[model samples]
Target chain A: MSAEAQTCPALDAKELDRLRGLCRQARIDLLRSIANAGAGHTGGAMSLVEIVTALYFRVMRVDPARPDWPERDRFILSKGHSSPGLYAALAARGYFPKERLSEFDVAGGMLQGHPDMLKTPGIDMSTGSLGQGLSVGIGMALAGRLKGLNVRVFVLAGDGEMQEGQVWEAAMYAGFHKVSRLVLIVDCNSIQLTGRTDETLSLAPLAGKLEAFGWRCVECDGHDLADLVPALERAVAVEDGPVCVIARTEKGHGVSFIANRVEWHAKAPTPEQLAQAIAELEGAK
Target chain B: MAETGLTYTVYDADHMTQAEIYGAVLTRLGGERPDIVALTADLAKSTKIGKFGEKYPERFFNVGIAEQNLFGVGAGLALAGFTPFISTFAVFTSLRAAEQVRTDICYQKLNCKIIATHSGVSFGQAGTTHHCTEDISVMRSFAGMTVIVPADGIETAKAVAACCDWEGPVYIRIGRGFEPRCYENDQYDFQIGKSIQMADGSDLTVIACGPSVQHAVEAAKVLKAEAGLSVRVLNMHTIKPIDKDAIISAVHDTRRIITAEDHSTIGGLGTSVAEVIAETGKSCLLRKLGIPDQFAIVGYPDDLYNHYKIDADGIIEAANAIMGTELEADEDWEDEF
Candidate 1:
C-alpha cells in the first residue's frame, strides 16, 4: 500500500478496486433505475460514478451511523440532476436501505428526482438549481473553519454548470480566503445537456483557469483508479489554498453504447438494454 | 400607593439614531458573547457594525463587496454553531443578496441574524437603487424570518442583543446616521413580536415603526397641542407577527388609524396593519403615510423622508386626514360576530 493510502483509514487499493466494481454496478443500477422510471440523467451520472465512488468509499470520513456527525466531511453534488449515481453510492455505504434504490423517483420515495438534504440521508445540501451547490458547500466549509473543526468539504461541479457566473464568484472567494480544506472536483465529461461544452460555452484550458484563480490544480484520468488515487492524495496534501481536481472523464462511461454520446445524457435504458448492461458489468466483475 | 415598587426611569435621550445604538449595543454584546461573529460586505464602516468588528477581530468576517457570498458564508458559519450577525446596507442585503438569504438561510431555517443598516430612505443620497424602502415587505414575506425595525439607536442595540436567543432567521433593520435616540437606557424588555405603546389617546391612533416611529411620537405632541387630536402612538417595531391586538383595539376605541413607516406604501407597515384590520372587518378611517408607489428621487435621507411624507409633518397630516374622514359603522357588526 502507498503511504498516502495507508494514512487514509477509509481508502486502500482493495477498497478502490471494490469501489470500481461498485461504480460499474452503480452505472448499471442507474441505467436500470432510470429505465424503470422511464426518465433520468444517464450521461452525467455515468461520468460522476468514479468520482462519487472515490469520495464516498475512499475519501470522505463520513459515518453512515451518524449522518450529521459534526466533524464528518461534507460532499455537495452541485450537478444534482445526476443523483442516481449518488443514490446508489449512498445505498452501498448503508446511508439508507439498499432496497430503497429501486424506489427512486417513485411516488412518496425518500429519494426524489433531485437530492434533498431534508429527505435524503446522505445529501448534505438540497440541490436541483444549478450554480447553487457551490455556495452551500462554501457555507459548510466556512462553518467548519469558524468552529475550528477538522471537517473538509468536497463539491462536485459539472463542466456545464461552470457556465454560471456564481461559480466563478465562489471560486474567486475560495481562492481569496485560501480555503485549503475545500476540494472542488470537476467532472469534465466535455458534454452538457444540450451539446458539446466547447460548442455550448468554451471552458477550454480548465486547469489553467483554476490555477489563475489561486487553486492548486490537478488533472487525472477519472476512470483509472491508479491516477484518481494519487490526484486525490495530492489534493488533500495541499495545506494552504483550495484544490481543484479536473478529472478527464467520459460521459456514460463503462457503457460502450452510451459512452461519449450526448443523446444518452438523460435517456433511460430499455429492459433489453438494462439486461445487456448488467451482463457486461457482471462479466467485468 | 405612595411609593410605586421599584419605579424605573425611562430616559428620553435625543439625537442618536438607531444605527448608532446598534453599533454601541453590538460592541457591548461582543464582551458577553464570544460566539457572536459579525460580517460586512465591504460596508462595515458605513453600516456601523464596524464598531463590533473593530472590538472583536477574531469574531469578525469581512467578505468584501460580495453580498451573495456574505450571506452564504454567514449562513455557513451559523450552521457550524456560530452566531453570525451579517451587516450591510438594507438595499444590498435585501435586493442584491435576496436569493442567498432566502435559499441558504431562511429556507434552511439557519440561526443567522441579518443586521441591515440604512434601511428605507436612509441611504437617500446613494440614489434610487440604494434606497431600501421595500425591504420590510420583502423580508416579511420570506418564511421563517423575524422582521424587526427598531425605533431608534437604543432599540437597535436592544434588538441586536435580543437576537442572541432568537431562534431561526432574523432581519433587523436600522436607519442611517443622525437618528434621534428613542430609549434612555436598556431598561425595558424588548420582545420579538410585541409592540410598545408610547402614548395613549382616544381620538386617533398613529401606528409607526423604524425611523418613522420618532416622527409619530413628535406628531402626537403636535396633534395634541394644535389640533386637539389625542393621538395614540404605537412604536410597532416588530413588523412581522405584528401586534394585531394593538391595531384591533386602537381601531375599536379610536375609530381612526394612521400608519407611518419609512418604507414603501405597498407591503410594509401600512399593508401589515391594513391586513389585520381587514381580517377583523372593522371599518375604521385608515391612511397609510409612506413613500408612494414610485422610486424615490435621489437626495439625502431627510429629503427623501420629507418627499415621501413619512416625516413628523407628514404623520401629522395623515393623522388629520384620517381624523377628518368618517367610516360608516356596520349596523349588524355585533350580529355578525
Candidate 2:
C-alpha cells in the first residue's frame, strides 16, 4: 500500500490489480455507452478512463451514497466532452446504477452530453464549454477554505482545451492567489477535434507555461497507475500554491485502431467495432 | 431600517450612487450572512465592490481583469453553497462574459447575484466600449435570470439585500455614480418582478427604469402643472418578469404609452413594454424614448441622456406626441395584427 492511498482504502498489490480490472471494465462500459448513444467523443473519453478511475476509485474522498457530502474532496471534469469516461467511472464506483450508463446524451436522462452537476450526482461542477472547469475549481477551493473544511479540488482538462484564453486567466488567478488544495490535471492527449493540437495550436512548452504562471508543474505517464498515483499524491501534498500535473497521454489510448486517431475524436463505434474494441480491452492484461 | 431590515437612509441616498449603495449593502450583508461572498474582475473600486473587499479581505476575490473567470468563479462558489455577489462593468458582465453568465451560472441556475455597475450610458464619458446599453436586453433573454435595474441608491440597496433571499441568478444593473435620488426612503414596498407606481394618471403612461424613473416623475409633474395632462409614471425596475398587469392596465385606461430608458431602443425597457402592449391586442399609441440604434457619443451621462431623448424633456416630448395620436375606435381585436 502506498502511503498516499491512506485517505481511502490502501492501494496494495491486490487493490491495484482490482483497480486495473475495474479500468478495463470501465473502458468497455464507456465504449458500449458511446456505441449505444450512436454519438460521443470516443477518443477523448477512452483516453480519460485511467485518470477518472484513479480519482473515483482511489484518490478522491467521495461517497457514492452521499453525493453532496460537504467534506468530500471535489473533482471537476473540465474536459466535459469526455463525459462518457466520467459517467462510466461514477457508475463503477456506485454513484448511479451501471445500467443507466447507456442513457448518455439521451433527452430527459440524468446524463447530459456534457457534465451537468445538477443532474449527475458525483459531478462537482457542470462543464461542457472548454477552459471553464479550472476557474470553477478555484472557486470551490476558495469556498472550502472559507468554510474551514478539509477538502481538495481537482480539475481534469483536455490538452486541447488549454487553448482557451480563460484557462490562462484562471491559471494566472490561481497562481497569484496561491489557491491551496487545488490541483489541475491536464490530459495532454495531443490531439483535438480538427487534428493534432500541435497543428491546431502548439502547446509545446506546456509545463513551462504553467510554471511561469507560478504553478508547481509535474509530468507523469497518465495511463500508468504507478506514475499517476504518485503524481496525484504529490499534488495533494502541496500546501503553498496551486499544482499542475501534466499527464502525458495518447488521445485514443487503449484500442489499437482508435489509439491516437483524430477522426475517432467524436465518432461512435459500430456494433462490430464495439465488439472488437471490447475484445481488445478484455484481452489486455 | 424598515421592514426589509436594510439601513439605507434618505441622507445616504443623497450622497451615494446606486453602485455605492450596492457596495455598502453587500458589505453589511457579508457581516450578517457568513455564506455571502463577493467577486470582481479587477473592477472592485470602479464597481464599488471594493467596500466589501476592504472589510472582508478573505471573502472578497478580485480575479484581476478577467471577467470570464470572474463569473466562472462566481458560479463555482455558488455551486459550493455560497451566495456569490459578482461585480464588473455592465459591458463586461452582459457582453464580454455573456456565455459564462449563460452556461455556467444561469444554465445551472446557481445562486449568483451579478451587480453590474455603469449600465446603459451611465459611464457615457468612457465611450461606447464601457457604456453598456445592451445588458437589459442580453440578461433578460436568459431563462431563469432575474433582471433588476434599480431607480436610485435606496432602491439599489433594497435590491442588493432582497436578492439574497431569492434563489437562482439575478442581474442588478446600476449607474456609475451621482444618479438623482428617486425614493426619499426605503419605506415603499419593494419586491422582485413587481413595478412601483410612482404616480397615477389617465391621459398618458410613461414607463421608465433606472434614472429614467426620476425623469419620468419630474416630467409627469411638469405635464400635470403646465399642460394639464395627467401622466402615469411606473418605476419598471424589474425588466424580466416585468409588471405585465400594470402595463395592460395602463394600455387600457390610457390609450397612449411612452417608454423612457437610458438604453438603446433595440432591446431594453422600451422593448419589454412594447412586447406586453403588442400581446395585449389593444389599440394604444406606443412611443419609445431612448437611444435609437447608434453608438452613443462620448459625453457626460446626464447630457447623453438628454441628447438621446431619455430624460425628462424627452419623456415630456414623447408624452405630448403620444397623446395627440388617435386610438382606433373599433374594439375588434380579431383584425389587428
Candidate 3:
C-alpha cells in the first residue's frame, strides 16, 4: 500500500495539523527560493502558499512516483509568476528532491522563470502568457470526460490576469459546456504588475461577473483555512458546470513589511528582509 | 464535322482535386481514429469538415466564432496529447489566428493539424475578407510549419492521412465547396515536400499548386494542341520545402517557367520559385500568374479565378508570353554570367 493509504485511517486530526505545518514550511521555503533568485514574484507567491499547500497535501490524488498516471488530477498554475510557491509545494509533496529548491532560477536549473511543463516535474502545462492556461485546463477536462477518466483539473488565475480577453472566453466556454470536473481559483490579491487592479482596470463585482458567466462563485478569505477548506469542498461537490473560488488574499500575507504591498509583486526580498520575513512567519506559528 | 466521343483514361480521372477527397477521407479516418479530435469555427459545413464532425459528434469541437482561441485551445489540446485537427476558413486561420498559431503551436512545436478551408479565391462570392489569397505566403513564412495546398479533395484526403504521421505543426489548405476533385484514388501516395509532375515537355514549364494545378495541366493540353508548345506541368503542392531540384531542372531544361497559384504574386509560389531561380543564375524566362497587387473583385469562385486570370487560359497566356522571349544562346550567356 502507499504511504498516504497506510496512514489514512489513523491520526485524522494529527495529519491535518501536520499538513498545516507542511504549508507553513512551504511558505518559508517559498520566501527563501525567491530570496535566492533575487528577482521573482514574491507577493502573489506568498498569497497562494496556503492553497497550494492544501491541494498538494490534503486534496489532490497525486503519486510523485507516477507523475504521468492517466487518472491523476492536474493542477495548472495559470498565474505562472508564482513558481516559487509551486516549486516549494511540489518539493514538500516529494515531487522532486527538496534539495532542488536551491537550484531555483540557477542556470541549467529545471525551475525556469515561468512554468515549463517539459522542464519541471508534475507541471501539466507551460503557462506564463496570461489567459491561456484556463483554456488548456478546460481541454484537459474535456479530454478526461471524453476518455471517461475520473480525473479533475484545477486552474489558479490571478485577478490581474483575468483582465485578459481569452480568460473570459475560456470562462464562457467552461460554463456553457457545463464542465463540472473543472475548478478555477482566482487569486484575488487585488494587485497587478502596474498597481492595484482597480487602478489598472476595474474588475469590481468580480464574483457577479463570474456568476453571470454561469460559474458557482465562492468567496472566502484565501488565507483562512476554515473558509478555504469548506469553499473548496463545496466547489468539488457541485455536479453541473464549473466552479470559481474568488480567493480574497493579500498580495503578501505572511510578512509584515511586504504584506498588501504592490512593490513586492515580483520583487525579491533582501537578506535582511528575508530574515525578518522568516521571523514573522515563525511568530505566527 | 465528325462526331468524336473522346474517352478520358482512368489516369486522367485519378487526378481528382484533394479538397473533395479530404472530406470523405476525414469522415472515414474519424471512424477509425477515435482520438482524432475535430474543431471548427462556425464554418463546418462550408469547409466540408462537417462530414467528419457529423460522423463523430463526441470527438468534434465547434468553438463558435473565435479563431484565435480556436488555435490556442487546439494547441492546449495537442499539449495534452490529443491529436487535434482545427478547421476554419483559411483567411481567419492564417491571418486572424496567425499570432496564436505562431506562438502557441509553431513556437512550441505542437502536434496540431490546421486544416484551413476556403483557401484562395475558393470563396469568390464572399468578397475579399473571406477569400484566403495570402494564406500560403503567411503560413509558409512561419518557422517549423509544414504548408500544403492540395490540388483537390482526393489530394486533401491524402494530405490529411499524411499529416497524421507528421510529428509537428502542419498547415493544410483546401478549397471551398464543390472544388473539382483532383486525385485518382486512395492508392496514390502524398508526400509533404515532394512535387508531382503532371505532364512532361521541353519548351516551357508551368508550376502550380492548389486549384491552379488543374488549370496548369489543362493549359498544357491547350498549349500542345493549339500553339504546338511543349509545356511541362508540375503540381507544386508543398510550398515550404519546395522541390528545388524540380525548379532547377525546369530552368535548365525548359528555360521558360510560369508559376500559377490562387494567391498574391508577391510572396506565394512566384516568390518561392524566383528565390530558387535567382540562386542558380539560369537564363530562364519566368512569369508569375496569381491575384494582382489590387484587392480581388467580388464574384463566384470560378468567375473570380477567371477575373484574376488564374485559370488554364491565364497559364497558357503566361507560357506563350515567356515562350516568345528568345532563349539566351551559349555565346551571350557566358559573358553575362
Candidate 4:
C-alpha cells in the first residue's frame, strides 16, 4: 500500500503459487455464483479465471477501497457475459465481499448478469456489448499519456468478440495514433456461444492480423500466470503502439466435461452437476 | 477569442455558420482549459471541428470513420479526466453509436459532450441515411442526459461553452448550414434544461427547436403584422428535463399550442410538449408539427420544411388553424390550475 509496494512487481514462487491457489478458489466461486443463479456463462468464465485473476491480484495496481485511484491500472471485461469470472477476481482482491458472489444475476443485487460500472464497484467501464472496450482503453491510455499519469489500461476480450468490426476500427486508431501504456489481452478460447470460433468465423492468423494492425503480439498460455506475467512485462516495456497478448485457452479450462464444449457457453450447473464439478476440481487439486 | 475569423461577439453574433462558431469556441476553450480536447470520427471537415484540430493539433483526435468507437473513446477520455467533445453526423450518433452512448457514457454518467452535426433534413440532398431526426428522441430517453439543440451560431457557442465544464453526458444536435438567427445576440442566459421564450403572445404559443426556432419566430412576426394574431414563440432548445413551467405557462395563458421541430413527430419535441401539457390536466388544442411517420422527402432543408408545413409559412398556417378552435378556460379549469 506504500510507494515501494506500488513499485514492486516481482512475485516469488510462493506468491505465484498462492495467487494460483486464489485463482482456483475464484474458479470454484465462479461456478458457485453461476450455479446459484440457475443460469449463466460457465465456459468463458472458467477460461478467464487465471488471466483475470493475475491481472487483479498481481498485475494491476488497483486497491479495492480506492477503486477510483487515478494512478491505478485499469481493467475492462469486454466479453461481458463472463461477469461471474470478473466478479470473482474483484471479490478475491477485496473490491467487494466474496459473499456477494452468490447474488450473481439475482434481481436487485450488485452483480448483474453483465458488467455494469454504475451498479458494480471496480468495473472501469460498463461493457456488455463486444468489441468496444479496446477503443475505450485507447481513449484512457491517450488521456493518461496527455496528463503524464502513471496509469495503464488493460482490456480483456474474447476471440468471438473480435468478430465485431469496431475492434479493428480501434486497432487502427491505436496503431495510427501511437498510443502506449495499454495492453489488449485476447482470450483466444477456441469456442463461442453457438459453435467453435473457427467454425463460426475464422480468426486464423490472428497474430498476423494484430501485427498488421501495428500491435506487437505475444502469445502465452492463458491459464498459466507464469507465462502471462512475463509476457505482460514485455508488453509494458514496449514503447511504441499498444501490445496484444494472445492467450490460447480452451472454452472451459478447469473442468473436464465442460472443456472445449460450446453448449456450456451459457448454461449453469444444477446442484448435482455442481457437486460433481466440485469433486473433479478437488481431485485435480 | 483565439483568432476566430469572425468579429462577432456575444453582443453582435450575426451571419456565422453554427459549426464555425462551435470551432471558434472550441479553439478558444482549448487554449484556456488544458483539459478540453476534441475528437471526430473522420468528420473533422464537415462537422467543423477541423478548425480546432488545426489550432490545437495535440488536443484533437480523428479516429477514422468509426462512430461507435468515437463515442466509446469519448467516455474513456472522460473517465481519464479529460473533457472530450466528440463530433460526427447526428445519424451515426443516434443509430450507430446508440449503444455506446447509452452504456458507456449515459449509464456511467461520464462528462462527455457529443456534438452531432447535420441533424434533421439539413442533409436533405444526402437522403434519409444522413439526415438524423431521431437523435432528440434517443438522447432524451436516456436518464442523466443533457440534450441541447442549439438554434443558431450564437446558441451553439453558448451551448458548447456550457457543456465543456458541465458534468454528465451532453448531446448537442446542430444543423448542416447556417440557420437564421432566432436571437439578436448571445446575451440570453443559456441554461441546461430551461426554455427560452423568444416572444410572449396570449393568443397562441408555438414551441420549436433547432432549425425550426427561427421559422417559428419569423411566423410569429408575420402573424402579428399581417393577421393581427399574437403568436408567442419559444425556443425549446433543451429537450430532456424540458421546462415544465414554460409549457404550463403557455397552456394557462394561450390555450392553443403548436410544437414543431426538425425531427420525427412521434418521439421528439412535439411528443415531449404534448406530454407536459397533458400531465397538467389542462385542455389545449395542440398541433404537433414535424416529419410524419414516413421517411423525409429529398430536397433542400428549406424546401422540405415547406413541404412538411413546418416552415414559417407552414407554422403561420398551423397557428391560424389552431387559433380558431380555442376552448374557453375562464373558470372551468380553475381547480386544475
lDDT of 3 by residue, B1-337 (tens): 0001112223433543344456566777776667688887787877667778888888888877877667777876776678888888899998988987876788667898898888888878888898878888898899999999887655665678878878889999887765554444535546889898889999999999988988888889999999998999989989988999999888877888899899999889999999999988767788999998877888898887787778887887787788778865865543422
For residues B1-337, what per-residue lDDT tens digits would candidate 4 score against the true structure?
Answer: 2223323464434656788788778887788788888999899999989888899998899988888889888888999889888899999998999988988889889988899899999999999899887889998998899899988888888888878767889999999987877777655788878999998999999999998999999999999999999888899989988988899989888888999999999899999999998898877899999999989989998999999888999999998888767476457765666
DockQ for each candidate?
0.52, 0.79, 0.42, 0.81
Off by more than 4 A, model 1: A1-13, A32-39, A102-108, A256-258, A263-284, B1-16, B334-337
How well docked is model 4, in DockQ terms?
0.81
lDDT of 3 by residue, A26-111 (tens): 87898888888888899999899878876776567778777777778889898988888899999988889988987888789998
Error of 4 at B260 (Å): 1.6
Runs with alpha carbons beyond 4 Å of true place in candidate 4: A3-12, B1-12, B326-331
Ten-residue region with minimum lDDT total, candidate 4 chain A: A1-10
TM-score, candidate number 4: 0.96
Local distance difference test scores for all models: 0.82, 0.89, 0.81, 0.87
The 10 consecutive residues of candidate 2 chain B with the worst lDDT sum are: B328-337
The chain A TM-scores for the candidates, taken one by one, are 0.94, 0.96, 0.95, 0.97
Model 2 clash pairs are none
Q: Find the candidate with the highest DockQ and give its number.
A: 4
Q: Which candidate number maximizes TM-score?
A: 2
Question: What is the clash tally of candidate 4?
Answer: 0
- The first chain of model 2 has a TM-score of 0.96
Give the TM-score of each candidate.
0.91, 0.97, 0.86, 0.96
